[model samples]
Target chain A: MSTIEKNVPGTRELADLVREQEEELAHLRARLAEWERTYDATPQRDALFSTSSGAEVRPLYTELDREGSDPGNDLSLPGEFPFTRGPYPTMYRTRLWTMRQFAGFATAEETNERYKYLLAHGQTGLSVAFDFPTLMGYDADHARSLGEVGVCGVAISSLDDMERLFVGIPLDQVSVSMTINGPAIILFCFYVAAAERQGISAEVLRGTVQNDILKEYQAQHAWVFPPEPALRCIIDMFEWCSENTPNYNPISISGYHIREAGSTAVQELAFTLRNGFEYVERGIARGLDVDSFAPRLSFFFDIHNDFFEEIAKLRAARRIWARRMRDVYGAKKPESWRLRTHAQTAGVSLTAQQAENNIVRVAYQAMAAALGGTQSLHTNSMDETLALPTEKAVRIALRTQQVLAFESGVTNTIDPLAGSYYVESLTDLLEREALDMFDEIDALGGVVPAIEQGWFQGEIAASAMRQQREIESGGRVVVGVNHFMEGSEKIEIDRLKIDESVERLQVARMAELRASRDSARVDQTLAALRHASSGAQNLVPAILDCARASCTLYEIRHAMEEVFGSYKEPVFF
Target chain B: MSESIRKIRVLVAKPGLDGHDRGAKVIAAAFRDAGFEVIYTGLHQTPEMIVSAAVQEDVDVVAMSVLSGAHLTLFPRVKALLDDAGADHVLLTGGGIISEDDMAALDEQGIGKLFGPGTPTTAAIDYIREWFSTHEAV
Candidate 1:
């Protein structure tokens, strides 16, 4: 219901400017008509000249495209209101974007080694990728976890595993980002307990947890509790973290998975910002101050193949979020209006054939992310389409960012595309489209309702189907997939394989931890957590108590599930 | 008089905790568009649920996508359950982030052709049709 007409010139000034440009515009139109007549006579190559999202692109963009908009309002300076240029005035000039590669596979010890290796190789921050069992709040020994333990990411079933995962690493010096949603609270508590064991207090902890569950229903499909209870847990984290972990972001509202799930750039922008707004509303409903929690709220987006569109998406995201926060939500703090984001190059855009070509694709996407003013980025590796990236591939992905930061000289200027006619016009167009979509979502009674009715899923699936058809029917040209001739080319990149014994090792470790931990304390703390889950109290303290008692991830989740129950997605394609 | 032909019924099931269902849903839509009956089992279906759905739906093929690197454990389990349930004729095939060597190994174990990333939907459609033409009695 929020309007995007916040800062506009007076009607009289607009009328006068239009009057001045009227005669020139008429002349320009006549010339454009004559040029079009000649242009139509000349036949060009037959192809689709549109963005990956199916938005039509005109052959040329000029001042006519940005005719009536006030440049001062639309293209604001960096560090100003509606930050379309960049979030900060000195974006990369002061500090480069963090090259945080999302890495984990097999046991905690193995992943711990990998983390140390990445840190030694100049990776600026740590992003954890937990295995399926850990992400779903299942123990390594659970029957549902058979064959999946530590396969996709690191398997941390207990505080012991979490402690081992961060062994030898100083918690105070390194910032960690955990990509967990379903059991984000449990993992977060374990992280705090692990830091406490290292003699570090929660006040100094700095990191982010991908605790977004709305997008889980819409795109990612990872959830433990139903929408209402899942939201309660997220709000509880917001309340607790605002008081305790001042430096840590409790939730990273994400559009990366949404874009990866086959949404258009505009859909990704609209859905993600709407989800962030829903969280802000929920946090306010919980009686928290907007500035207290909104400043800590961060964003994650996907940098896809369309370079200008991706950049425009980021610019539009910041402008829309800033306006909504200040104008609609009444957030007075400037920090609340700043939309800081972490971006990752699109993994869905990678090809399995001619995998090395992915390196080139990632380089361009990384550059786009850099130009888009991301605070941090994770570039996809070439071999990622086939399996988990090998060590060398991950290093190269990191080096891609390094080269962009240093060799590419893109960081020399902030918002280098700020005044370009095409970028500014596209940014405005994307913002308008997002506003329209927001109205559509508003008609559907908000994000959670739309998700329950499968509206978001349906839209994403339709776009995905359209893209697939385009690829198959030769409407789109993917270098090695449908267009290029690379018959009988063998993939030669080294693929990382998870050792099967890692699961056995984790299961045994879980058993040993269960046997050695004090059963009385564990049961007492878990009972307290279960009791607190049904009440309106902040659940973090109780969860942290359970973590300190050596309770496992599934144990904490089951305690909540006893009251919240599980979520079964509505079955649809 | 012309004889009527039964449509190829396929169940597109996602068999593990990995929630990357883009491929499964895309393939399901492709199959539906290609004039085949696709029963999408949605996300997080265990091997048992997949086999039961395939049996209950009476599908000609049970295509399960396992992208969580659990293919070695899941594909074989589903295939064995299909065989044990006296439905061995159902083709157990799907696609994911499976490597070529693993695909060969799964093929050796009687799993059908598995597709990887960036594969055209027509390839799977043609494969399923050719599979049905040879394996089923028209």
Candidate 2:
């Protein structure tokens, strides 16, 4: 203190300045208190003033609210450590987020034509939506796949279907994101084999397979094997892709389904980030460097109706992930610290009543995703609540992203709302809440154990029940649902009906594939897969051989099931 | 004669490969809170399994949630199975991403009233109570 006083000429001045500022701050606090009293005295609407996550929103937010937050450290510049502002320096200034519409239905050939249509209409990337049978690791002709073939998404059972899915589309030129879990590894092998058939090597391929399995057990419920074996397969992909396909993201640690399955925003952010960290820990446990696979690890989040909260969740996600990677996991690479994310507008928020309003909801959510620094975005179609989106509806959904990227001035700057006191406070709150949840999860012996104990599912179901109750009890207002009543308003929007013959066609195709392909090769590859499943060898290569031999999705799953066993969820309400 | 009123037993199930169970679970919980005995069959339930569970549980209502657009097939199949199992009196009612046209189509096939998105859990609860009161010996 003596040395500082001696060296600094304005020491006394500094003290005086601090005192004056303190007095001024006191006066401002007094005035603010008076203002709050006045505001409180005024009549207000009898509604819950809170975010969708039930976080209370005050009438005003100022510097007083951001008291303990160290702005410079908490929010460094974009592309810096603890990347709260954005992941990259010039986020949308250099290039806009990829407009990837998740589209698939009926047969492979039909979906291929739709992909071409989407591409021609200015879509940036291809996001494949597999049908239920394919997603559940069943062949189209399987008895379980009877009426479900091509009902939800495209049915891709073999490498032939995967090849037909991208007939003329160049794999090297297009980035494909496949939304398949449960049998994600097998489908990924089928995709790799399909690319190889097109003469595209694994090294040159770039895309993401939504190989997230933890969320399946926790929320989505599309699980094949138990947690241990499913995680082993995931770690196998992480190791295999680290060397074979460095550019491809082997897993998309998704909170989209978690939120869609009815979790709050903070829960989605925390659970998704926790799942990502679990993958990291697993990869490291498998003896791979954190920087090796962590860099390629990507995230998928759901953008709900709470605009500011959704944006804040993304910001907090980046910050928490960055700090965890660098400080917790002790990663050395900047890429390892960066949390790249793809966001989709919430499908649960859409309503069948006044379906057109969903377009606006999706548009706002898209803006939130853009403002939140998403690397990619998928906006939900208005007609999605009723059925699969029609072509026109999907086009409009894509156009929403286009308008946000082009017309919306939000892209003109990186993290335009970074310094906003409200956003910063919300981000801090979400981060703190998520950190607390992480501790609770740790107390439960981590993600897998927590899922096994049904903690995650219970939390999600409880939150979902609360939100449903809020909507029903008029605590929350869902337009055209609980509040606005358009009596006798018939839904006139054009609906897309999938022909039942699509199922029969897929069945016949599966039968034809069985009769034509080398039966001996299929049997041999499947046998090898089964054998490899029992060993410590990476299962990707074995699965790839099966895909090349035209083994059906179920055959590969069945072979692994012999060793891995199956996951039957603990049924509860 | 003092007669004991039978509590409406409901078997809430998810049919086909649809994994979305928020609706099913919510409805199940709501039915329970509304004083009904609820039995939930978790995800990936086949029609045969659902009907067998309904018959085994001897539930008055077999509410199935099918969001995979497999409702057109799943509902009719479950209904026919229940009929074959001699449990045709059980109500086949549930909700999902179902359209009015499809709802009407299913209703014509003797399926109970189907709910849609944004439908209050109370609507289903009240509908079931009304149906049970009218159909069952009260």
Candidate 3:
């Protein structure tokens, strides 16, 4: 037996024996000419070049091609340093990804029904989509929140709503992901309080809060304060999550919104990494050690329609993050190097026409995310094109994930698509492009300055415009769109219509909440909130205090705004 | 393509509480690259705010994108506001998950055409061009 193998034959010997006379490499030129004459016209094929993300495309790759590249440099084991394969060694084979489908509706009671429905339908995790009032740090009763109560998502103004939100769902078992940003600390506190009422200990609590305010200021535009205090609130959650709810993900450093903001794959990768770096810098500035809390730091990415490109982007993200944490940030712990991310199917690709078609789009996106190695996933429902997804739509979405996982045979192997020459080359290309962007951002001081100086915003605007021009000029073909003009496409679809009765019920509940709650405690809690805001203390404890005292979301935010102030966006065309 | 106007003044604004603005932002830049001045109001705007801004900006078109399923309530509110203010000249267009029948119904209310999702960025822009010319006299 040679050093290459104990008994089994090498790839070259096996390939020869298995195929034998079927081997066509020697007659490739002649076969190509005959095939071209038979099928296509062109025979010469050297004109292919780089795609937009800078991935070079050659004709083919063999076992020899794998030897010359740096494929020898071990990517560290799964769950080890620079976890390129996946964050955990066992991955979904041991425990499947948390089925964290997004849940939100009009009123607290209505949303609670949806949440219960998701739990009943085998959803392993919960993701709450708060309405604008909650996201903007305003209460339903606030003037700014007028006419906006529970429109896009569920409205939670006080602890009453939070209590009502998880009525029957056991808080201790199901891991929840709240998609709240601007006022994440307060929202997180509400969850803690709600779980406490449910007789659940904070130590046993498991969940994630999208405590990503930096991304809010940059792409999501859901900020309630200036950068400094907003960051303070974020740090408080990080510290609290570490000590209390240790299993919770404090901030899901998001590239999803940035991708949605019209950035190139490279820009999306670079900007998101820079945003994560800025968060780490913020935590370090707060006098916290990198290793102490970096383990719980997770990520959220948008899985776009570009199949291989999206897969390569996620692979490159893991490799870059692992390398950067170990080399640049001095993260010694293997957990700190692992980039565990949750992915959502691209909401941008869902078409309102033949709304059912979004099913296929979501299926492809989910597949891409799975191939890209996401730890968790949420697929947008087909009917999400119209309004909030109905139960039927959500179930179909969940089924799509099931089919990809159990039926498709894709999850049977570990990193099955790894070492593909084109994929590896693309991964390298994306990494290099992203590193170039990081270098540029580092030169400009960092993400916050880049944001304030209008550079980052300007880049998104420019990239978005370029893509739009290409699509508009007939260069890009969105099927069932501009290219293939067909008869009124059959839409056996029913749009989700929010019954007006839902609004009436919601307003009534708000009125009751206003009547039953003690006014004095709310006033005192809000006063404490204002006092805490004016000084150099974390807002989490105060926001928690306010949530406990029945202080509405608007009162808490307005109290802070009186001290911290709001943002007036820059005039950019 | 008609007259060499300064820029196709298009207000790519979102009305109501939908936080989904990626599509809106992408469309805005699409219009901007197609040589239009795009006014993108971030997220969470009232119909009154959108109408007032459209009037002050004197945009050639007011493109409202709503994903909250609040378009039925929101579109009528916007049309009412614009009508009362005598600003019907601004080509009022919308996009999101609104159905074709609903699109026809909303059109009867003077709210113009509805561009569904997956409708190419160029098609939206061309519709704006056709809309601006035919209704420019208003």
Candidate 4:
């Protein structure tokens, strides 16, 4: 045992030592006051510095911050038990964090070109952003999809589009992360089918599907099925991926959208982890071993403008998840306890005014993600607030991550801010706040129940309202927006515009595919999917069958909706 | 401003696959605070549903918000529905993520006074109040 642990100093002895330390601190304060008077100095701002979430930040930190606290076994080595510092031991030294840029717009062919461009420019992984129609599981030819086919992101309706998307890209080598939740399983099937066409085995594939459905109801509002059925679809992926594609993460429990929807960092952390725990519980209740599926589970977070607080949130996340996995869920494997995450810079923080300032903002937020020990990070482009980023803006955004990796010495140490008094204290404070929120959620009978009653939406709306009031009232300054006003100048940056012809071509292709494909086989596979969805059998293989039979995305989604029905969210303000 | 004056009844509808009602909800809350009787037809309302709601509620104004880039389809359809139903006097105005060119085309198509992201909520309130004052029903 170490000397400190062996000593176990009594309360009287500790009290005496603290008293002596206070005396010394008193003398040091007097000397500091004299020095300040000699210089006649004042700090830059008169107002107290606080975090974005309204946590008060002190001017200075000292050893006294941790005086009465004994961290005790919580402060273990990096890769050890609770993993508060990081998930891995040699964090960036072994392999740098993946610079995955989320880029997809216009058509699959166009997005394919962008993906190849990003890969050529040293991007380590691919993250896809699907267009609104595809996200809602609509084919390009659907009447509701008019004028929205390829506006926001790429449009992929069938396995043919998915095949074109990865035309030259090798499925075995690159890790792809798809940001779709509603029809995520259908998309995953398309990817698997596309890989099969390329002769890649399913077991060797690697990537993540952001199939977190509960957060859709709570925040993003991109859900297709009701919570109960949507969760069943997710558990289906968990069971299938555990056996078939061990390398791919079936679900990325996301707090990025939660924060983007106006939740504070604490709410984001609490609600996301609670969602993750709910998934684990569902998987366990489905008779799957926690250790088997838990290791492959991953997380995605939003690194907002609050630098230290964001880092603290990440640290607190790992600690809380680790403890809960081991203590609460009673998992045996170490990997089951480690909480790995991917982070993107906050999109809501990007302003339409003085867009170039967004570059500086993104860089700071990227550093915070790195310092927070993200396994992968996507830096938002400056033009995101106005429109989709042009190639130049994307290149600059990719370079930001490269600079942090190669030049900036932030990667030299693992969790460099781990022991700082402010960071540690903030980590503890955030953990306490998040736990309190978890208890409140539990009192409402857990995450799904809370979501049904609109409790989660209410909390997010309240926080969002508070934030908006602050910005409107000038209590919070948004640099060029609220202060430091500039006259309007014509924006010179080229924004990515999806051609109207792209939608026309996409609709034509979908029509041709529908006309040419074997309708009998499509009907057969879709019936199989509907049957499997209604019964207890896993739905993934049946979805894959539909993908193989050239059934379009909407066809497969409608098939399941036939059995499970669609969801209309309960409105909450 | 007499207490006996009728409140302006408005239908705030979200008519697309997009679930981003942050702006729509905020505007609805502000209109409520401004003493307007606001009927927020929540997410995924078809243009037909929106028109039927407008007729059913007898709302004076229909504020259609579409952030899903489907405004070209949805806004024109909503306007056509109001026209065919002879509720042309029911003002149809909306906004969100629509570009300058699209906004101009939509304005020419008889969708009135679309607002963007940063336009103050009070701008919407002011526009509705002014429209009600000028176009008192026959």
lDDT of 4: 0.89
Badly placed stretches (over 4 Å) of model 4 are: A1-48, B1-4
Model 4, A415-476: lDDT tens digits are 89977989998998899999999999999999988998999988888788778777767778
* Per-model TM-score versus the true fold: 0.96, 0.97, 0.88, 0.94
State how far residue A244 of model 2 sits from its true place (Å): 1.2
Provide the global lDDT of candidate 3 against the true structure.
Answer: 0.78
**Once superposed on the true structure, which residue ranges of model 1 sit more than 4 Å away at CA?**
A1-31, B1-4
In model 3, the clashing pairs are: A139-A554
Please give the DockQ score of every candidate, comma-separated.
0.85, 0.87, 0.44, 0.52
DockQ of candidate 2 (2 decimals): 0.87
Q: What would the C-alpha RMSD of candidate 2 be, to one decimal place?
A: 2.6
Q: What TM-score does structure 1 among the candidates reach? A: 0.96
Please write out the lDDT profile of model 1 over residues A67-140, one tens digit for every residue. 77777776678888888888888899899998999999998899999999999999989999999999999999
Show where candidate 3 strays beyond 4 Å.
A1-56, A62-68, A72-74, A483-488, B1-10, B23-44, B58-60, B86-88, B121-138
Per-candidate iRMSD: 0.8, 0.7, 3.0, 1.7
Q: How far does residue A100 in candidate 1 sit from its true spot (Å)?
A: 0.7
Predicted candidate 3 versus true structure: per-residue lDDT over A1-573, tens digit per residue: 122346787899988876753455446556655765765564664342445443565555444334445643434455655566678887777877777898887788888888888888888899999887788877776666655677778888878889999998888888889998887777888888888889998788887888887777667778777887788788877777788888889889988887787777788888888788777777888888888788899999998887888888888899898888888888888888788899999876776555677899999999989888899999999877566787899999999998998899888876777878677777777888999999898788887777787777778767766666655565655655545647327676655655666556666776887788888988898999899889877777788888888777777778988998886555454
Best of the candidates, DockQ: 2
Among all windows of 10 consecutive residues in model 4 chain A, the one with the lowest summed lDDT is A485-494
Q: How accurate is candidate 1 locally (lDDT)?
A: 0.92
